[model samples]
Target: MSKITIALEAAVATVIENSPKDVRQTARQRANVDRAFAGILKLIAPRIRHFIRQYGLVAHWDDAEQCCAIAVHRAIEAYDPAKAQFTTFVNWQLRGELQSLRFRLMTDQRPSAKKVEATTVSLHAITVGTEGEEASLESMIEDENALSLTESAASEQMAGDLRAVLIGRYVDHLRDVGMEQLKRAARTKRPAAQDLAKPRFKAPNHGIDPADIADMEAKLAQHVHLVERRIFDDTCLDDLEQEFGIAKERLRQTAKRAAKTIAELAAAEPRFASELNRKLPQRRRPSKAAVQPAVTIVPDQHAAHNLLTNVVAITPEAGEPLAESIDARLAATLTTLVSETLN
Candidate 1:
């Protein structure tokens, strides 16, 4: 049959023939079975590495490698090729082992006070980037001020109502057709005399006749297309296809059209640059607004008060040694509790 089937059959034959004489085999068959096991392990090692990376288990690669090896051995011993492919059976066993290891590692450690402090410091350092390349606190503040100014200028230029419609229709929910329909409905409801009496305005809306609402509609269509590309990358295509009942090819074509329109609008309009500059404020570096204060609350407040009072009242003679011991123990317990909470 297939190469896999042939290999598996050979492996099984070897295993059966290699069985010990007392247990049910010959030295020759045993050697063949051992050779098969080695061959299978070599073939699967790359697959194990690929799986580890694919699942973001790279940090635990060493343990995952060992687990995969063990899983393969177990699979070989228990495999029933009549019911399932050997590769499929082995994959199931490997997944189960890896998941078990993940659970064990997650649950085994009791978090300690030192661990919490270390994590907090690490997160703070990460926000500032690497040591040499980090922006100075002063520079960060200045950049923030510039961003805010740009945003205010842009906001002043764009009609508040139109900006809200653009953000709500395109940026937030990606309802391009719905946005167009809404605009059309609003135009229909506008007083008929107002619609008819324009100065018949024309260019330096740049080749786009300022008199034409068609040009603005065209620009809005382009903006929505650019946003969809950013939100849905290749990994999301399958889900999008399933949810929308559209073939992958059709969805891709639609996305491309939208992106092209957005690129055109960005290229054609001076206001686009100003708007982009304003939006830069939305991309500002995350601030410490959400940083939480570190605090420990003890349920046994009365006990804690008594202990503190006794330590404070200690006299030099008999109390000093006992108080030192109690202080050390209290410090250790507090450290452990803090660590667990932080973790």
Candidate 2:
């Protein structure tokens, strides 16, 4: 190894080295807020044009300029003194933000950098309510998965329907409680053994026997179409009343009571209420076009049965006895064939 001899001199500041007295650097550090946001517009302009041409992400040039300004502001906070220029440091930062914006736009999350101020929603903000002050948005918007009105209403209506069905099921039982109390004369009389033995109605017990409640649920399930039709579609109270042969006022009262009961159930047992939405019946409406094609009773012979059949009138409505007429001689054969096939 060759030995090298070095002579030391007073060091001078190179361009790469930081100068404590540099006026421009000091000004940049102190007065960083520049009113000329359009300063960076030229830098981001070509990129915006390229993005529009290549990706076809529909965003105005002004929007890109604003985003670049925001990124530049953020980058200024992290400006490295070792970097050759502040502008170069900001260029890369602005580029990254624009690229991120492009990716977000591609995914259909169009962020409005200009319109939406850089702020935060305090998810824990306290808001006063009828009951008391409570947690804010985080508490209120609990079900983010339930996004659509139809979906939200379906769940809500199920709970309501279940509550209504429960109320309607216990109508006679509740009425009897009031009636028996009212008819108990001021003067003492012989207490009926059955009345004395009857269970006292305390309500989260639902004022009814558990067996009666189970029976009600079964009945509601069997006639779920009634609830679906009345609550969900073609909600004609008069039609329902006439169809069921119940008094119109009585029907209205029953409906009103059911509504009130559902509200109570929701307040008391919200978790159980939310689960009830799964039980809501969706009404199936068959269009005339859809129905007419599927219903053609083609009287064809079957090899399995070795029977031939002809068709006669089978009326579905009172308008007319609609039927496809086949050979009159085969009418008996067809009737016999149908009976045998069905059996």
Candidate 3:
């Protein structure tokens, strides 16, 4: 749009083409030709900048500029005045070169679309499972070494006793987790209809009878209360030291046994473990009730610390009598009651 560009274009159309006989020979004709070339450069200069930016050629601008210059020159040389306007012809030519330029600058540009190969793995080729009955990798399988069935029980003697400390800590952990989950559930707003349209997850079967849990809880609670009070009393610890040569470690193991029993009890009856989630009262439309999820304890830092502390406290001194007394039997009997279900 510059005056020089406009003038050069007009000059090329009129003066340069019409005065071809005098071109290169006459100084005036040569001036017109030079003007036309300058005009061409001006026309493609902005386009070259655009291509550089569009093709991410800014890092190699000088090279891109040179390429664009060559493309422009080729366009001018190959131009057919009878077929199209100079501007249209130049645009078409530049477009082709720009397409190729874009490919070259792509870093991984290919001549055509990349062909993707279909991938399939032969699971049947691999055999797995126990010796004789081994099946292919495709068939459902499991490792026997990984076959660990967790049962809640202890040695016959200690099975009668349960540790109150472990049960109390487990209860505390459960309460904490329940509070957190309830708070989160309260804060959560229902999703939109579209979101609800998506498939909802179905919880796996717990296989627990809540009624059994209630019965076990009642029996266990009575024992747990009595045992916990005795455990904290120094008289009880001294009695064990004076009568039974029971190791403090044996006490912790006893607690662990009780903890395992509680776990088994809960597993046996999920309903008693946690009440079904009850929604907060609403004045208007009632809200859908959520299922109350049970809390599971995995031994971690806090649990480990609790165990260590209990061990230090319950452990009797080496100087104390290792001999079992009648008083120690009461302690063992009370602890054993934790596992026994009330008739």
Give the candidate order by descending lDDT: 1, 3, 2
How many clashing pairs does model 3 include? 9
Q: What residue runs in model 3 are displaced by over 4 Å at the alpha carbon?
A: 1-31, 105-107, 111-343
Selected candidate, larger TM-score, 2 vs 3? 3
> What C-alpha lDDT does candidate 3 achieve relative to the native structure?
0.57
Ten consecutive residues with minimal summed lDDT in candidate 2? 3-12
Q: Where does model 1 exceed 4 Å of error?
A: 1-5, 20-27, 107-343
True-vs-predicted CA distance for residue 196, candidate 1, Å: 99
Per-residue lDDT of 196-292 in model 1, one digit per residue for the tens?
6557554333232333446556655564443443343334667766665668787677676655654555545575657665644455686668867
Which residue ranges in model 2 land beyond 4 Å of their true spot? 1-32, 35-70, 74-92, 98-208, 222-224, 230-343
Provide the overall lDDT of each model, using Cα atoms, as 2-decimal numbers. Answer: 0.63, 0.53, 0.57
lDDT of 2: 0.53
lDDT of 3 at 132: 63
Model 1: how far residue 195 lies from native, Å:
99
